[model samples]
Target: MKFKHYNQQQTVLLPYSFDDLIPEQHPVRVVDYVVESINIQPLLKAYSKEGNPGYHPKMLLKVMLYAYMTNVYSSRKIELALRENINFMWLTSMTIVDHNTINRFRSNKLKDSFKEIFKQVVLMLASEGLITLKQIYTDGTKIEAQAGRYTFVWGKSIKTNKAKMLTQLEDLWNYAQSIDNDDNPDPEPTQFKEINKEVIEQTVAKIDAKLSGNEKASSKSKAKLRYIKNNFVANLEKYEQQEAILAERNSYSKTDTEATFMRMKEDHMRNGQLKPAYNTQISTENQIIVHYTIHQNPTDTKTLKPHLENFEKTFGKETLQQLKEITADAGYGSEENYDYLQEKELTAYVKYNTFDKEQDKNYQKKNKPFSKENLYYNQEEDYYVCPMGQKMHKTHQSKRTTEAGHTQSLSHYQAKNCESCPLRGQCFKAKGNRSIERNHNLERHKQRTRELLLSETGIQKRKQRTADVEPVFAQLKHNNGFRRFSLKGLEKVELEFGLMALGHNLRKKIAA
Candidate 1:
C-alpha cells in the first residue's frame, strides 16, 4: 500500500490561484465583502503623501478584521497567517504585510479613524436589515487590561501619604519656630494642603536657615528636616502627579494609567481579585454590537448616560432621535439614568436594585411589609402612613448630588412619635422616631418602570435582552478568549475592541 503520488521536489506547472484555493462561502469572503462596502475615506486621510509606498488601508483593514474574526489577535500571528494561511492570503490578494506594519496601521493610523470604520460597518448592517437601531440592549462587562496585577496606584494611598507629609512639614515648621524664637513669621507657606515645588523649596530653605546654628535643635531633628527637604518634597510632587492622573477614579494601574482596578467576574478561584480593567459598555440589537464605549469607572450605574451619549455621538443625532426603546439590567437603573432616559423620550425597561425583591412573594410577605414601597403615600396630604397607622409627614426637602454631578431632590419624612408605639421594635432600629428620605421623581420612575417591565412587551424585551446581548460577550470572552485586552492605554484599547466588535458583526453576518 502506498500514497497516490508524492515527490519532495515536485513542482506543478501552474500554481493554484487564491480564488480557487479559498471556498465560495468562507467567512473570509464575508469579511472582505463588508470591509469593501464600508466607507474608508477617513482612514485614507490618516495617511501622509510624503512616505514611501505603503500598504493600502483597505487591504490592511481586511487582513486585521479577518484576523480578529478568526481569534488571531497578535500582530505577529496575523503576519504569519498572511504568509501561510490561504484565506488571509486570499483576503489580502497575496500581499505579505509584516507584523510591524500591521501594528503601526492598527495603533497609529487607525487610532483616530477606527471609529469611523466601525460606524460605517454597523450602519451597513443596519441598512441590510441585519440589526435594528431603533431598539437596543445595553450592558457592561469588565475586561482586564494588559497591565500587571500589582502595578496599582490608589488615590487613597496618595492622599494618605500627602497628609502624612503635610503633618511632618508642619511639625518641622513648629520645630524651626521653637528654635529661632523670632517673633516675625517666615514669609513662605503657611498652608501645606495646596503645596507646590516652589512652596516646598521656600519652606525648606527657611526651616534649614532657622536650624542652621541653633544649639537647641537636636541632630535627629536636623536629619529629619534634611530628609523632608530631599525625599519628602520629591515624593510630594510625585503624589500630586499621581492624584492628577487618578482624577475621579479610586485606583489606576501604573503600567496603564487609564485602567482602573476593578473586581472582574472571570476569577477562576472564586476569590474576588481586583485587577486593572476597563468597563466595556456595549449596545446590541439582534445580537450584533452596534456601539461600544470603554470606561475607567468600574460600576455600570454611572456609565449608562455616557454610554448613550457616546452612542448618539458615534451614530448621529438622527439615530438617537429615532431610538424607541432602551433596556438594561438593574445595575444601570439609577435615578440619574432613569431621568436621562425619560428626558430623551425613550421607553426604559431598566430594573432597579430592588425590582426583583419587590417581585418575590416571600420577600414581599416577610421583608417588604415595612419597606418604602409598602407604605401608603398620600399625595394630597404630603405624608406617608406607616405600618402602625402613624402619619409620617414631610419634615423637609434637600438636594443630593451624585459623584457624576447629577443632582436629585430628596424629601425627608418623619413619624410624629414612636416612643410609645406598639411596633417600635419592628418599625425601625433607630433611637429617634423613624425617618425616611424619598426621591419622588425616582419613585415615580420606578413605578412606571415596574408597570413596563411587568407588561407583555416589556417581558419579551427583557427575555430578548438576555439572549441578544449576553452571548456576544460570552462568545468574545470565553469562546474567542478575548477576556484581557492586548493594548495598554484606553485609546488603544478602544481601537482594539472596535476591531473586535467590527469582526464580531461581520462573523454574525456570515452566520446569518
Candidate 2:
C-alpha cells in the first residue's frame, strides 16, 4: 500500500518551545516588546497590598493589543483566542486571562495608562524618524456607541415638555386653592427662569407645608391635594429628573447618557437616524495616528482647538514648534481656527467652503453678479454695486454670533432704492429692502486661506492630505472592523480607542 498510515492520537516533542514558533517580525512580537518597554508601576498601584496574585499587566496588555491587531475586539473573543490560537498562546506565554478581567483592566486599570502607553509608542516612532510631526492631517469620523438609537433624550424635547408640565402644575395648584374657598384660586402661573427637579421638589414642599399647617382638612380640599400630589407634583418631579440628564448635552441616549446622537456612516439603511455615537478626531502622519481625541460635537468645526490643546499638553509646546504645517478639510475651516493656526505660526493649508469654487472658472463666471467676490465693491466708500447697477451702501457694523459663541463684526449694506428696480425679483426676495451683511473679518481670513490653498505648497499639501490620515481611519474601521464601541462612558471609550491606536501604531512599526 502506497498510502501512509495516519493515527488520530499524535504526541511529539519539539526542539523549540512556543516562543520560537512566532517569527521575529510578527506584530505580536512588536506588541510584547513595546508593552514591556512601558512602565506599568502606576497601573499596578491600584491593586490590593495583600491578595492572591493576578495576571501581570504586561501579559494582559500584550494579549489585548495582539487581539486588536488580529481584528478581535471583544474580550470574550480574545479570551477564546488566548486559549485556542497558537499566536495568542505565543504572545501570552500560555496564560489564560478571563474575558471579564480583560474587560475590567481595559475599563479601569488601563484607563489612565492608555494615554501614557500610546504616547510612548508615538514618541518612539518620532525618535526613529518614522513620524515627522511636521504635517498633521486631521479628520474625524462618527463611531456608534454601545447605546440604542431609540433611547434618546433631547434637550429641546425636555424643555418643551417641562413648560407644559409647569402649566399643569399651576392648574393643579389653583384647584387645591379653590377647594379651600379662596378667591385667589387661579393664581398667576410661576415664571421660572430654569426648571429642574430641585425646583419642583421645593414647590411640592411649599404646598405640603401649607397643607400640614391647617391639618383640619375638608373632604373636597383633601381630594384636591391628593390630585396635586399624585398627578401634578409627580409629573413636575419626573420632568425635573429628565432635565438633570439633559445637562450640557444637546441630545443623549437613554441607554448611554454620555453618548450623543450622531449620524453614522455604517448605517446601511441610510435613513439618517441619529444613533448614539461619538465624533472621534484623529491626527495622522505617515499613515499612523499620532494623536486622537473623542468629542461630543457632531461637526468637526469646533473640535480642532481642544484637540491641539491636548496635543500640546501631551507632547508640550516644544513639540508643536517642531511642526511645520497642519492640514484639514473644509469642516475645520472656521475663522477662529484660521486665527489659531496663524497665532501658533504653523502654516495651515486648510480648505474653506469657497476654496473649490474659487478654483472653478465656470462657477466663478456663472455666479459672478450674485457672488460677493465678483461684485464691484468701493472699499473706500464701503459700498457694493450690484449687477443691475444698484448701489448698496454700508449702513452699520453689527456683531454676529455663532453657535460656538464667537462674535464677529459684520458690515451690513442696504440698497438705496429697491422699490422699482428692474432686477428686483432676481436680486431681492424680500418685499422692502435688499440687505447684505458681510463678516469682513471672516472674509479676510477666508481670502488668506484661499491664497494658501492655491499655492504650490498648498497644492502639494492637499495631495498629501488625501493620502495620509484617511487611510488610518480605513485601517481602523474597515481592516480592523472597529465601527462601534463596546465600552460605555467617554473616559472608558477614550481608553479603548487609545489602545486601538497603540495597536495600530505598533502594527505599523512591525510592518515598516
Candidate 3:
C-alpha cells in the first residue's frame, strides 16, 4: 500500500490566558481574600522598607500557600512550576522567581507569619457561621521524622556494642595470623581473607586510639565517640539492608540516621520494621484543623491536654469556651485525661476500650463466677459491697494535691470484708482481702460517661472524629507519600508537622 501526503502549512493558536483557566472564586482566591479580610497591611508596613528589594510578603505567601495546597512541597518544584504551569503562573502572577526565594519564604518568613494567618482563617469561618466551634476532636497520628531510629545510640547499648566489636576484631585478627602461618596458605588468599585482615587491623587501631587511657578527654567524651562510631557502623549496615529491600520492593525508603519510620494506620506493619516517629496532633472543628502540633511522644495519651491548650491559644479563650465537647479514640483515654476534661468543664467521649465488648466477654469467660461489672460500689458508705452482699468498711482516706493544684480524694476499703464474704473465692484470688480504691473525681467520670451514652449530639460528633482525622492521616501516608519525616530535632519536626496540617487544611478547602 502506498500513501501520498499533500504539503500544507497550518498555524494553530491557543487563546486562553493562565488567569482564565483558574476560577475567580477558587480557594486560591481565598488566599488573597483572607489577606485582605484580615488587613495584613499593618504587618506589611512594619516589615517593608522603601529602599529594600524584597518580594512582597503577601505575594510570596500566596505562592507558597498555593504550592502547599497542591502538594508541591519542594521549593525547587514550585519555582519550576511558576515558569511552566498555568495555575502556578496565575497564583504568582507570572513572576520569574528562584528556588532560594521560595524556600526562604517558606522556611524563614512564613513559618512565624502564617501562624497568625491560620488563626485568622479560623476566626473568619467562626464569624461567618460556617463553623459551629461548639465541639472539637483531638487526636494524634505518627509521622516519620527526618531522624532515624539508629540516630539515638543509648549509652548502655553503645558500650555493649563497642565491646562486642572489639572482641570480634581481636578474634578475626588472631584467625588471620593463624591462617597466614598455615602450611596450605595460598599465594593469594581469598578476598574475604584479605578484607577481614584489613578490617581487623583498622578496627584495632581505632579501638586502641579511642581507649588510649588519655586524661585530656573526659571518660564521658571518649565513651560518646565510641558510641557514635558504633552507631555509624551499625547505621551503615542498616542502610545497606534497607536499600536492598527497597530495591527488591521497588520503593523509596529514606536512609538518613535522623529519618523516622512513619506509616498510616493501615500501612503501619507493611514492612515489619518499627521506626522512631513523631505524633502529630490536630484540633479540629467543623472539619477544619484549628490548631496543630508535633510531639516526640509515640503514644496518643500524653498529647491530649497539650493540643487542647494549643487550640485554646490559637482561637483565644473566649472562642475555646464555646467548644463544649472533645472527642478522641481509646488511645487518648486514661484516668488523668478524665480529670483533665472534668477540670476544663469540657465533655468528652473518649472510649477506654475500643473493643470493649469482645474484651469484656473474653475477660468474663477467662474468670468465671465474677465479672468486672459484678463489683458493686456503696456510694453512701464510701465503700464497696461484695458480691455476697457484705458491706466493706473504708480502711483509710488519703488526700493529696497535684502539681496543678487539683485535690485528689482517695479511699481504700478494708481487706477483711472480702475474707468473710461467701463469694470471697470468686472476688479475691489473693490470700489477703481485696481492696477497692476510688478517686474523688469518679463522679465526674460517671457523669461524662452518662452524657456520652445519652446525648445524641455527643454521639454524632464522636462518630465523626475517626472519619475526619484518620482520612487526613491516610492521605498523608499513602497518597502524598509522607510515611516518614525528612528533618531532625523536635522543633524542626514540629515545623514540618504544621506544614503538613496546613497542607491537609488547604486540600480540604480546595475540595470543598
lDDT per residue (tens digit) for residues 180-252 in model 3: 4346633222222322334544654544453456444456545545554466466445544555543322223
Q: Which pairs clash inside model 3?
A: 144-485, 146-258, 146-259, 146-487, 147-258, 147-259, 148-257, 148-258, 148-259
What is the model-wide C-alpha lDDT for candidate 1?
0.89
lDDT of 3: 0.63
Q: Please give each candidate's TM-score.
A: 0.95, 0.87, 0.69
lDDT of each: 0.89, 0.80, 0.63
Best by TM-score: 1
Which predicted model would earn the best lDDT?
Answer: 1
lDDT of 2 by residue, 369-436 (tens): 76666678887888998888888898988887888777778888888788888877876578887878
Clashing pairs in 2: none
Model 3 residue 407 lDDT?
Answer: 68
